[model samples]
Target: MTLKELLGIFERQGIKRIDPMGQKFDHNLHQAVAQIETPDAAAGTVVQVLQAGYTIHDRLLRPAMVGVAAGVMQQVNTSA
Candidate 1:
């Protein structure tokens, strides 16, 4: 009846949600929509999830749309 109940039914039917937050980026499970430069998290880590992903019985139904963390670029001094 409610959304939570529906989700529970889906879960009972072997549907699982993929949570990518704070996890390492995986091409198979996550689709990187954007890359953000930050020093807070390691590069190639999933920083945000734009869309949730799902799987059924170990088969992926959809990949999670996410934003991956990129290492901050440092300026190189060329002046001698």
Candidate 2:
């Protein structure tokens, strides 16, 4: 069977996908694989999902692997 067909079977049985794209990054729900610079979203937000996670019965089966928006570092000057 095709991949979509196989997945459809599981989805029918209370298996759901955890696609957290464009959502704020949550450590409890998502696993940050890398941080990327993005102006489109706020810092610590999810930019892209490298791997999709899954859930069953509202419980986390696996954490979604994603790339989070990174904050730009600022330089500070100290004067005597």
The best candidate by TM-score is 1
C-alpha lDDT (0 to 100) for residue 35 of candidate 1: 100
Candidate 2 ranges with C-alpha deviation above 4 Å: 74-80
> Which portions of model 1 show Cα errors greater than 4 Å?
77-80
Over 1-80, each residue of candidate 2 has an lDDT whose tens digit, in order, gives 99898789879988788889999998888999999986778899999999999888788899999999998776688886
lDDT for residue 27 in candidate 1, whole number 0-100: 97
TM-score of each: 0.91, 0.82
Tens-digit lDDT string for candidate 1 (18-57): 9999999999999999999989999999999999999999
Output the lDDT of residue 46, model 2.
Answer: 91
Q: What is the lDDT of candidate 1?
A: 0.96
